[model samples]
Target: MRWLDADEERAWRALRRMMIAIQSRTAHDLAAAGLSEPDYEVLSTLSERPGHASTLGEQAAKMGWSRSRLSRHATRMEARGLVRREPDPDDGRGCYLVLTEHGLRTLEDAAPAHLESVRRHVIDRLSSADLSALERIARKLEEPT
Candidate 1:
């Protein structure tokens, strides 16, 4: 395959740098909320549901995570009183994940700060045209090959 031209290479490098920068800043913001990146991710995933609960496989799928990874994280969160695991009544072999009261409260408190961080460090830096370009790029990337 043909390699990128100098300008394309520069653009690619800059995009990579931006991604790393945004991820680091977001992780730091979550850490300040007394949650690690993975913790926040799992909690956030559950929070999006109607009752803050989902099956282990559903959570894994939503986060593009492995079942083992979700299981390990769930175990730690359960020990910390942030979440609880129970057998799915509909399917004895399946497990259901529920966010505990503490998890809900923590996530609610963290949402504002996290949103502001994203706005300031990412969205605010972009113009409307830039945002449109970003959306187009993301859509293209998400499309099936």
Candidate 2:
């Protein structure tokens, strides 16, 4: 197998560093709001849905989290009045996770600052061409083998 050249290796390392740093910083920010990255993702996912609700399995898939992890986080959120869990009407054995009013409000309030942090740390640092290239690369990497 061919190895990356110096430039490619540098770029790959940089990308990895950025990914780790960004996640760390974002997690810290969310923690300040009494939310973890997974917790934030759960609310963010439901907020985008038609009724701020989704099935537990769907939420797990979207968050790339295990069922047990999602369930525990959902349970914590429920205790905090950020989310509600109920039996899926369509399937008695299934569960639905819904964002509560407080969840929506918290996300709405945090979004602007969150976006600004993203911009300051990630988006603003990239040129338009760089962003397009990154998007193209990401699409290729995300494709099913």
Candidate 3:
């Protein structure tokens, strides 16, 4: 296998650093808003659907999470009055994840701060050309190898 040249290695490290920086900055913002990354992920995903409700399987798939992970997180959210699970009438084994009013409120409150952090840490750092380049690079990386 070929190794990166010094310049390539430096760029690789910069990319890695940027990822960590983005995660940490947004995490700090979320923490200040009384949320963890998992909480944010669950809430944000559910918020995309009308009424903030989706089948458990769909939520899990959309978030790239395991059913067991979703189950565990949902259980905790349920206990906190953030969400509720309803049986899917068409399928005895299926259930719908419903975000409660409290959940929506919390997410709404956190979104502005979260968006600001994202903008500060990522979006505002790039020029339009750089942003376009990054999108292209990310899309390339996302393609099936």
Candidate 4:
């Protein structure tokens, strides 16, 4: 087995810890806005799309989630009147997850606080060089093997 050497192991551990810390802090910040991370993700995704709607499959793919998982979460959001599903006009077998007025309002309200939280937890903590290095690392990781 190819084991991580001392330097690699330290870097890996630091990366994991940083990610967990950021995620926890961000989640806590979102909770104050009356939204969870998943709620923010779904609402934001729909809001960014044209007509504020997307097919379940498309959204799931975009979010790197399973269709079933997104579908179940959509049901919960729908129950809360944050989103709604409509029959797809072009595809009889599929439906589009749409952002409702309530959803848009909720997202709009939460966005400012969310942005501040992100800046506080991440952007403000990093220098321009750090951000550039992070972006390079992210792009490298995202490249196909």
Each prediction's TM-score versus the true structure:
0.88, 0.85, 0.89, 0.95
Question: Using lDDT as the measure, what is the rank order of every candidate, best first?
Answer: 4, 3, 1, 2
Please write out the lDDT profile of model 1 over residues 1-145, one tens digit for every residue: 9999999999999989988999999888878888887888888889888789999999999988899999998999999999999899999899999999999898889889888888988899999999999999988977779
Quantify how close model 1 is to the true structure by its C-alpha RMSD in Å: 1.8
Best by lDDT: 4
Candidate 4 structure quality by residue, lDDT tens digits, 9-100: 99999999998999999999999989999999999999999999999999999988899999999999999999999999999999999999
- lDDT tens readout by residue for model 2, 3-120: 9999999999998998899988877776777777777788899998878999999889887788889998899989999999989989998899999999999888777777777787
lDDT of 3 by residue, 1-145 (tens): 9999999999999999988988988998889998888998999899999888999999998988899999999999899888899999989999999989999999999999999988998899999999999999998977779
User: Which of the predicted structures, 1 or 3, would earn the higher lDDT when compared with the native?
Assistant: 3
> Least accurate stretch of 10 residues (summed lDDT) in model 4?
135-144
Please report, in order, the local distance difference test score of every candidate based on alpha carbons: 0.90, 0.87, 0.92, 0.96
The ten-residue window of minimal lDDT in model 1 covers 29-38
lDDT of 4 at 37: 99
- By TM-score rank, best first, the candidates go 4, 3, 1, 2
In model 3, the Cα lDDT at residue 45 comes to 91
